[model samples]
Target chain A: MKLTILGCYAATPRSFTNPTSQVLEVKNHLFLIDCGEGTQMQLRRNKIKFSKIRHIFISHLHGDHFYGLVGLISTFRLLNREKELHVYGPKGIKEIITLQLKLANSWTNFPLLFHELNSKEPQLLFEDSAVMVKTIPLKHRIYTNGFLFQEKPGERKLLINEAVKYNIDVSLYNSLKKGKDVVSEDGELIENHLVTADPPPPKSYAFCSDTVFDPDIVPQIKHVNALYHESTFLESEMDLAFPTKHSTAKQAATIAKLASVKKLILGHYSTRYTDINLFRQEAETIFPNVDLADDGAEIIVE
Target chain B: MKLTILGCYAATPRSFTNPTSQVLEVKNHLFLIDCGEGTQMQLRRNKIKFSKIRHIFISHLHGDHFYGLVGLISTFRLLNREKELHVYGPKGIKEIITLQLKLANSWTNFPLLFHELNSKEPQLLFEDSAVMVKTIPLKHRIYTNGFLFQEKPGERKLLINEAVKYNIDVSLYNSLKKGKDVVSEDGELIENHLVTADPPPPKSYAFCSDTVFDPDIVPQIKHVNALYHESTFLESEMDLAFPTKHSTAKQAATIAKLASVKKLILGHYSTRYTDINLFRQEAETIFPNVDLADDGAEIIVE
Candidate 1:
């Protein structure tokens, strides 16, 4: 799985900095997460194709989180996109977008689908044979949700040499890969494990942003391959974090340590700071495997 | 009068080019015109203070024209602005912006006054001691209005040497600057023209965008010092201009000539063109003093 940070800044978009927006490429799916203002431009700057994005997940209705959504939707229409577009966000997102479209009188020619989410409990948002996406309910100033993307396990790998040595027929190779016992050409039963190796472990990534440091989300995001958490402030500004419903770098690292996530990526830095390395320095005190996210940065999930 | 082009391209905003948005600094007023996406960032890039912008004029409901208004408004609130903001646009603009603010629950602390307009004829929108703004109805796909920002005549320049030669009292200088004749202390009648020169000719700037090749607006914008007109297409693509309710460079030049505007500024070019100078080349065939607008280009209204 690969993740691209299109924009990671907090609050307002600046000339050189952007707000919250990213793209996760997993299992042949390109999921756009939290499109803020100037997201479309960031997507263009990152050289990401606009048409590949089929699903857009918005965490909340905050301007910094979803202001670019309507513009992106309108651009898709201008590009003559015909594929269905799915938007999953807080309950009022549909009304906010539809009203703008109504006023502009430029509705999309393609299928525009809106999935308004208001569930407080964790719920599955999307699923297919290859991937599953679930919501990690988050506590914020308003209704918000973080998304968890998990890749499904692949088919078991067949060991051709071991299968040949076991005298298993080639036609039964498919059954062996499915982890089922198959009859050999010599009429002997062959165990699936004897001829096939287990597939690589499935990768998972969790995106959490614009939320206060809450240990409650640790259980939901536990043991993920990669976790992206908002670190709007550092330890120096700890007093301003909770009241604003944002997380400090140390607080994000504490959650990462409690959840045992394999890797913790910190982002959503406030523009007030001149040096972003301070966040990494602060988060490293709690979690050793911490990575700082910047605009246009790309990460590979292990 | 100074005009800063924030984003002058037509249609969707791109990585380097922006949609329609510009800042006109006239008579101590920083007027934002046609705020598209990425406008606030552009304002920052141009080093224009957000608090100085008390008035915003939106040409239409097109996404490219006003998508950045809500974000700019929200950013104002974030900056703790207490000054009232006045928005002038079509009737539906208030609903479009208010709904988004409602959904985000981030209403502005400052007074946001919306002047919704639905007039087909030229109507005065704002008037102060220094400036007067009126609508120049434009023909587009939807209800749209261009704005004419006219600088009110300044106080007459009192020729100090001439006033002293006439033995006029210093206390009467204010009245002399107001173009009034005053009786000299020596009982001599001094003519206003003898002591004071006429105030500089009132400078006027008319902003016309996203409109077809309509001649109806010529009279309203006639003899303006500067005219910023949309030239979304050149003569080569003139076929696509009128059908899309846009004006070609030649068409804009023709209107400039018809209106007898002092200077013609060609902007809102379609992003498909590689060279924007072609717009000036085309417009110059019909009218001289044509300036091509780029993202950060600044023009002084002569």
Candidate 2:
């Protein structure tokens, strides 16, 4: 799995920095998160293929988080895209997009799908053969929900050499790979564990931003491979964080430490600070595995 | 009066080129026209103060035309703006903007006024002491309208020495400036032409884009100081331009030549061509005063 940070700065887009947006690549799937303005330009700069994007997850409807969505959708139609695109976001997104389409008098030729989340509790929002995404209910000023992307466990690998020595039927191998015990024609019992090896360990990632220093979400995102949380302020600006429903770097580290995530990626820094090294230093003081996100930077998950 | 081209290319935003957007500075007012994506960065690069912009005009709802508006509005709020902003565009703008504000739970502290246009006939949208803007209906796939900005005719200026020798009263001077014959206090008939000279001719600029070669709009913008029209293709691609509701370089010049405009600015070239000089050559073949629009280039009206 790999992750690319398109923009990490908070508040607004400037010539030097941009707002929140990123791309996560896992198992032949590219998932987009929080598409701020200029995200399409950032995608082109990083040489990411436009067609690889099939699913988009929006954390909230803040301009910095998902304002680029309508533009991206229009670009897709202008490019004559044929593949269907799926979008999972908060409720009222469909209405907003449709209204713009009405005024523009332009509609997409491809199928546009929307899955709106209006619940307050954590629920399964999306699932397929390779991946499943669950909502991680977060405490915020509005109806906001974080997403947890977990790689579903795959089929167990067959112990081919051992199965051949046992003279097992090739047709029975399919059932054995599914962790089921099979009976041979000679009335011999073959254990599933002995015939198959364990599959690769599942990896997961959770994205949460624009939330306060709430630990209630710890249980939902416990022990994941990587976690991206908003650190819009620093230790000095702790007073402003809570009132604005934002998080500081130290507060983000505290959550990362409690959740025991393998790696913590901190982003969404305020534009008031010219330099960002202080964010890394502040987050690393609490969480040793913390890394500051830079615009256009890529991180590999091995 | 001065005009700066932020982006003038035709199609989607490429890695290097951009789409339609510009800044018109007239009478100490900054008017943003068709804010495409990356306009914020372009503003920064051009050293334009954000506070000076009090008005924004969107020609259409196409993504390339006005996709950057929501982000720009959010940025203004983030920067703690206090000035009232007026946005003039087609209908449905209110829905898209309010949805973002509702989801973020943070609305602008300053007042935001909108003038949504859904009219088929030409109408006056905005007028002040110095400037007046009228709609110019154009033919496109969508309901699009171009803007014509004409400097209002000012009061005639009286030569101070010439009027003083004639013993003209201050109150009578007002009538002289208005180009009206006034009777002096001594009952002497005063000729308005002898007391004052004619004011400089009012300058005007017309912007017409994202339209086809209809030539019906010539009467609306005839004999203007400058006219900017979209030329999305060269003469070789004229066949495609008609079906797509775009214009070729020669077609744009045909309108300019028929209207006898002072100057003609051509823009909105398709991305298929790497060179832009061909457009200028094509337009100049028909019109003597023709120039191509490029990003960051400015035109100063003398």
The per-candidate TM-score of the B chain, in the order shown, comes to 0.98, 0.94
In model 1, state the lDDT of residue B268: 92
DockQ of each: 0.83, 0.62
Alpha-carbon shift of residue B69 in model 2 (angstroms): 2.0
Instruction: Name the runs in model 2 displaced over 4 angstroms.
Output: A155-198, B154-200
> Model 2, residue B285: displacement in angstroms?
1.6
Backbone clash total for model 2 is 0
Question: How does the DockQ of candidate 1 come out?
Answer: 0.83
lDDT by residue for model 1 (B79-180), tens: 999999999999989998898888887789999999999999989999999999999999999999999999989999999999998898999999988888
Cα lDDT, all candidates: 0.93, 0.86
- lDDT at position A291, candidate 1: 89
Query: Hey, what RMSD does candidate 2 come out at?
Result: 3.5
